[model samples]
Target: MDPAVLREDMVDGLESATKDVLQDEAVAVAMRDVPRHEFFDDERLAYADREHEVLGTRVLSPRTVARVLQALALEDDDSVLIVGAGVGYTAAVVAELVGATNVHAVDISRPIVIEARQNLERAGYDGVLVDCRDGAQGFPEYAPFDRILLEAAAVEPPRAVLEQLSADGRLVFPRGSQRQRLEAISATGDRTRFEAVSFAPLLVDGEQSGTLERNRMAREDREHAVRRAESRRGWEQDWIEWEHSVSSR
Candidate 1:
């Protein structure tokens, strides 16, 4: 079967009555144009709409990608920053909508970043820049992105990422911890919530795969411990906000 034919079938399924996930005509068209099979060794399964695991990070399903892009509402030439560029599949799809040079991606896992860069190049999108960075911090070198996409869930969307949005820019992310919703926030601070979804929590420094510390809670525990240590009489003040004054420390 030709890859083009497979992509057409994939788009058809996404637009079908049962799925109806790819409602945006531009999103559907861009997705159809991207060579998703190039990102996979087994091209046969590339068109499957289910999530796949790679480098200890979950590759978002096609429906999830559709939802994110729809929420982003990307325009031609819109600069996109992908916070969790796992296999670079979403970035490649975005490159179809926005030029390859306009797509910037970052991942907390170094290996994933390297792999994502390679994957994007293999998918014929070599101009998309993929970097190793904390997803919370975002890719600030190219700050003021027209559109930003966070592929992981967070209880509170990182303020740094929000700050990186261009004036009138939009951010799409899975918000919440145990329960998550597809949320889009504009640079002007208006929020739009979409359907409920589940995604793994975002990773931070020293917590990525193959790192010494598997403790993702270390940052919070450290913050609370510091608060206790700094207390006048150990427990003088309650730890209502675990991240109070964390930046100064």
Candidate 2:
């Protein structure tokens, strides 16, 4: 089936599954415009009402994305900050609701950030800015955003990121580690809680623990190789000296 058709069908399923998710025409339109298939390799699952892992992060189901976007109540002129942008699908949807220029997406994974930038561009959202950074800190340069969406689970809202919101901004995120609740916070600190959902922990600045351990091991291997080379050179020197002495005798 054509991707556009599949996308429309997916939105339809989302609207049907969730009570009033696609009531907003903007969100409905955006969901239709952004081709979900461009974000993932599996075209079959692209429009399915299921989640897939992309770049080590979850590409949330259309139902969840619709629910979050609907809860956000985005405006065309609103500036959006999307944390944990996985392959840029959600960002593209937001860009469609708002103008592409009004969206700034940040992800801690550099490779994922690069992939998202490429995906957005490929999907014709060239104006969206996808950056590799600590999403927990938010994009300070683009502070005062009209809305902020966290695609990962956090134990609590990061004050730094929350501070970046505009006076009337709204922020949505899944809270807790083992068990999570989707919490929506208003600029004035009013909060609304939704149903439980599981999401990966939010990543922060600094080398990832796994990457750090791998780097340490690589450094140790290099050091061991250098020591072995030096030892071999010492042995070679000894052999040369003995040969010279023997020849002289």
Candidate 3:
């Protein structure tokens, strides 16, 4: 069982007229070359065309990856950012198309980010930057990406992500909360919609896995909350204090 041949067969099924999920030759080659097994404990499942759970994130299946890359229509040397870099497989494939250094990815879950980084490194795409951050915010430090892909679904494109796109850049995402569809939007606001798809909702601060604290809070804020909770004036406030309610009445 050669992994290379498995990759070839896997992609072949995707390209066959019956499924026809793959059309972009570049993406097909990249999928063939990137060692997808590096991201999985069982190499057999790596080429099975099914989703795997990695650190609470669902890795994109190959057909989904193909559909995304086709929508992106990437060109060489194009800078790309991937939100929700689960296991880093998609980012690695993208690295093949546009060089590893040109790829950047961010994830809201720190554990997932770490997993993605490790997987990318093992897959020899160490040049790709994987960071822990809110996906909706995007990797703005590398602002103005030539292309952006949000693997998670959202009701609409996050405004901050849109802001990070280069004027000529385009973003691909699954839109909607319950009924998601693939969509691409240009920086100038032009949009294109494609086939229906399903993806987990994008997570925000405080909602990320393993977090129990409120979002956007400083250490000072947490300390203040603790102090307030321990103090008396009852440690809790009503919608209207008794005195204030009487005065207003």
Candidate 1 residue lDDT tens string, 137-209: 8888898899999888876668888999999899999888778999999999899999999888876653555
Q: Model 1 lDDT vs. the true structure?
A: 0.82
**TM-scores vs. true structure, each candidate:** 0.85, 0.80, 0.84
**Residues forming the 10-long window of minimal summed lDDT in candidate 1:** 209-218
Off by over 4 Å in 2: 17-21, 207-249
Clashing pairs in 2: none
lDDT per residue for candidate 2 within 176-220, as digits (tens), equals: 877998999999999999877777777554333122111122245
Sorted by TM-score (best first), the order is 1, 3, 2
lDDT of 3: 0.83
Q: Model 3, range 50-71, lDDT digits (tens) per residue?
A: 8878776788888998998899
**Number of the top lDDT candidate:** 3
In the predicted model 1, the residue pairs found to clash are none
**Clashing residue pairs, candidate 3?**
none
Local accuracy by lDDT, each model:
0.82, 0.78, 0.83
